[model samples]
Target chain A: MFNRAILIGLAVLLACVVAPAQFRRGGGNAPKEGADAPDFNLKVLKTKKKKIKLSSYEGKKPVALIFGSYT
Target chain B: MQFLLVYIREAHPSDERRGRGRGRGRGPEVKQPKTFEERTEVASECVENLKLSMPAVIDNMKNTAGTAYAGFPDRLFLVDKKGKIAYAGARGPRGFSPEKLEDSIKAVLKNKGVAPRKSTKNKKSQGRGN
Candidate 1:
């Protein structure tokens, strides 16, 4: 029974360590400062029919991309 | 300078973070939207309730923009005219400071030799002479 307990404890510890690493990996890589911003084409929420691409504003203006949700 | 609010996945949903409560009295108690249409609907409600003046866009269901920018929860970024990331705000609820963002915008405009516009209506007219 003692051996089984040690095995279970080791398994839990391994899982704890691996879980966070997996979570961090799940977040993917973010663009670094001074690097070219990744281009995206997204639908305008106000006008659901219309779509906007980040590349369209590449040379025209300085863009502020505020990323968030209602919650 | 152009501003775009990219709506991402919910930070606190009724199902995931119920214990925290929305804080505001009877605040929106919505679940994480499952469909693109549902997500857009939630975003519309946010825009209307907040009376947000800037144009808002909805990230794809896969959250491409969110993953690329690490924008989950909330964050702000300033992209220069050359399409490079001029400023990437720290991950939010804590780092979501509009003043800091505005300061960065002003600095960028100054660097380009453009004076910041006084009127809210003139915000859309920037970067023209460049």
Candidate 2:
């Protein structure tokens, strides 16, 4: 009986964690096609440059955003 | 004219500390950075090593750009002149296709009445160009 309860508990935990990811496949929560991309300000490493915000680039040119890490 | 690379959480966070390969294939071994500075160090190393030509934005909180963009591994987005989302490419590895991004950029530029200019940098090169 204890094993059965533990198994059910683990199953519930897995579902809670993975369900959100599965539901949010590619394009999840991201701006819709044609919607304005949300603007953000992020710090640039190793420079005196000020924070960079998406709105700052408006009307100047198109912006390509690449999100990743070095691994 | 603008490209933003948001460095988020490490993809192979587990393998970051030490070089994992063998023989001539050996590489530098550094642990997964637990803080923003550590992550930035690793990121800077990668940029220098790859000679990438695009600028990068570091997501320190690991929330804003990282989680918001679903940027665990990697993703690409093209915001057009009007600031609208022109194209959204699939995620990395199997979904990672540089051609798709290049094609999308070209298409948007053409639509915006701009000329097509081939990238001088190698396709695989990854770095944050100043």
Candidate 3:
């Protein structure tokens, strides 16, 4: 085994290497290509309790789903 | 091609009411919503500020859609007419690339029709290596 100083150095290097993963939290468990899109019926913005269903778009046209927040 | 926006959880909430702390968000500072109504309000404001013309839908209080797709903060996807995921974009904050997304969209649209066309010209003349 390496001496104490060398071991500490190795640990620090490893931590630095993997530190970016901690920042990029999500995106794992995301659906892959050719997989069935998850069906969701969410409330439409400014609508009178109306909802938009993802399944409704199927077989009609290609829908580009953009997921995001304001800030 | 049709575009739809699904407003999910707050990415960088200054108050850190729920999700991770991003110090100060790029746009106006917004706190994590404690209820569905608040989330809707913020999402509306966001669409307005960004001038997102496409229709939008708000995630529920539990963030079900966000958790289901693992699209916290932001993400992009293309669902083909068959309801299958045609393309899944990289994660957000840094991986959220619009250029790449546009390319994918173009590709999806190009393959929309299966019209078998006649091959007028042969590529044997310009074949480099195969």
Against the unseen true structure, what C-alpha lDDT does each candidate score?
0.77, 0.68, 0.75
For model 3 the local lDDT of residue B14 reads 63
Question: How good is model 3 by TM-score?
Answer: 0.76
Local accuracy of candidate 1 as per-residue lDDT tens digits, A28-64: 3556556788999999876655999998887788999
Model 2 per-residue lDDT at B64: 82
**Regions more than 4 Å wrong, model 2:** A1-27, B15-30, B113-130
Please give me the DockQ of candidate 1 compared with the native complex. 0.37
* TM-score for each candidate, following the candidate numbering: 0.74, 0.71, 0.76
Q: lDDT by residue for model 2 over B43-112, one digit each (tens)? A: 8987788677677778875568766666556778788777777766566645666787788788877777
In model 1 chain B, the worst 10-residue window by lDDT is B121-130
- Candidate 1 residue B44 C-alpha distance from true site, Å: 0.5
Residue runs of model 3 more than 4 Å from their true location after superposition: A1-25, B17-25, B113-130
lDDT of 1 by residue, B1-130 (tens): 8999999998777767542665433567778899999999999999999999999999999999998888877788888877887766666766567887788788777877232324555433421210
Which runs of model 1 end up more than 4 angstroms from their true locations?
A1-28, B17-26, B113-130
lDDT, residue B17, candidate 2: 39
